[model samples]
Target: MSAPAVGKRQDRSGPGTSRLLAVHLRIADVLLRLVQLHALWLGWTLRGGLVLGVFPATAAVAAIARRDALGRTAEGSWGELRRDFARHWRGQFRHANALGWILAAAGALILIEERVMRAAGDGAIGVFVAGVLWMLGAGVAALGVLVWPLAAHFDARPLAVIRGAVVLLLGRPLAALAPLGAAAALAAAYYLVPGLIPAFGVAGPLWLVTAVLLRGGALPAAPAAAPEPR
Candidate 1:
């Protein structure tokens, strides 16, 4: 029906796969709401619409994987998008528990960045605004940081993942500047969500995932052998 009415109409007075499904569905819904609320704030300040906006992109990739795993995106075009979104939403609970530390650490780093930028006489409004956008861009681009193992976790190739992971990781310092640049684009979102959005963006968790994925060359294919016995 509508965003607010989604979980409202469901009766919790039942038990079965339907109930589990309902729980998952609700979890997914809440996750999106969180992302939205978070993004809105960052959007105001940073102007890039927070890391959650990147959800559209991340969800796009994840949907493809889920579609492959479950066989067919039979839910029609719109239905497919909604279904994948719900699944991705529900999946964040895992991140909530496990990835919280990473996010917290990232927050500390951002604050440090904030103080440094602010002290440099970059103009309070300008630096604050710029810093927020930087966080948002960094969070999502950081997601790209994990693209290597993410592809692998979904059974991507070895050489490809290695090459891509290196590119993303090495490129991180440079790529991070976009979010920093986006700050000048807008500051309205930051005001709304405060630290929830771009302030406490997704960079930390993404970095975690990227590191894990790249460490062992976790791509689906076996890493190439030591060029055999010559």
Candidate 2:
């Protein structure tokens, strides 16, 4: 009889050892996902070539992460990651960047107002400016939390995504706010360890939003995939 092929090895370990190996692999998968997510986010943010591709790139990763979390998609290998990124980057590029620019412009306006309010200092006008600033800031934050998830799971115009996020936040304040708070905490962690952004920063926020929204029934059962980063 021919000898067993050298490359066709079979496991001879006991059942307990196989189970232990499975657990170790699961842990490694989780770690790898985090690292991949961070790298995706960091690469797009830094080297987003032409038309500010970071926005769509980040949104694509969020979509992939959501699918993986829900078991709709498999745990991604590097090739899978690349394919998903390319698919989403092409599909979502225009809409994602459009929304991003709009948000950036709004934020810039708010910052200018904030500076003006500080210059005015201590009066009725100051109080009004502060209040306006607070409202605007909160509005932006609320929108930020919902937009990317909407992009991942819906088929709609960019304006519709914005509108839907507003409606969802208003209708389900408690559910939305909890995840938002978690996202904030994760962001704080990233700030303290900026180095981790290239290996884990984006995963925490993406996972929190995707998992919470799915659990809370904030998202539809079937994802539509209309269009951005959260």
Candidate 3:
């Protein structure tokens, strides 16, 4: 009787140990994926020469992250993911750059406005104008934060992508917070660790955005078809 009881206990322990090991393996797998995705993002960004590369690289990562969040690519191997990401980056390069540069120009305009406001000196009217400019800057940043994910998930023109982002910002404002918070947290972490910037920095926030949008029903029922440059 004692021997059988010992065997039963061992069997129970075996399953528990297996479960724990499985959990650890799953975590390791996820971390490895993030690292690989980050590497791809960095490589592609540098390939584009940073200025021109950043947006398309971002779109590629966003697309991959969206697929992963939807479980469409959950079982995809790293090679498959890399291939898909490259396709996205190349296909969307022109459109992504157009979208990105437009936002960049807007950001520059906002900065110019801020400088002008500062030159106006500290007065009641100047203070009021400064507050309005700050709000405008925040709105532009929010649009930017939402736009790449929209572009990745939608096969639309840059203008349409901007409109979609606007609709999402107006309609599901609360849902937007998840990705923004993720971005803020990642920034804080990178500030502290620095090394993580190259590993999980961009991929981490984009993945969170993709996941948040998917869970909140912000994405279409079906993934957008691969877009072609027009």
Which tens-of-lDDT digit does each residue in 1-230 have in candidate 2?
23464323443446668899999997787777778776766666565673487787667777776676567765556877766667776677777888767777777888888888888896998988788898998898778767887777786777788888888888888878877887888889889998766667666687777767876677776665534332
Q: Candidate 2's error at 72, in angstroms?
A: 1.6
RMSD after CA superposition, every candidate: 16.6, 7.5, 2.6
| Model 1: residue 15 alpha-carbon error in angstroms | 55
Poorest 10 consecutive residues of model 3 by lDDT? 221-230
Residue runs of model 1 more than 4 Å from their true location after superposition: 1-77, 100-104, 113-230
Error of 3 at 174 (Å): 1.5
TM-score of each: 0.29, 0.79, 0.87
Per residue, candidate 3 scores C-alpha lDDT tens digits across 25-140 of 97887678789889999999999999989999988888887777777665767787777878889988999899999888988998898889899799998889889989888888
Badly placed stretches (over 4 Å) of model 2 are 1-27, 45-47, 191-195, 223-230
Give the Å shift of residue 30 in candidate 3. 2.0
Q: Which stretches of candidate 3 lie over 4 Å from their true place?
A: 1-16, 74-80, 221-230
Q: In candidate 3, which residue pairs clash?
A: none
lDDT agreement of model 1 with the native = 0.42
Top lDDT prediction, candidate number = 3
Give a tens-digit lDDT track for model 1, residues 146-201: 54234424433334533454565456644433433343223344466566444334
TM-score of 3: 0.87
Query: How badly does each model clash, as a count of residue pairs?
Result: 14, 2, 0
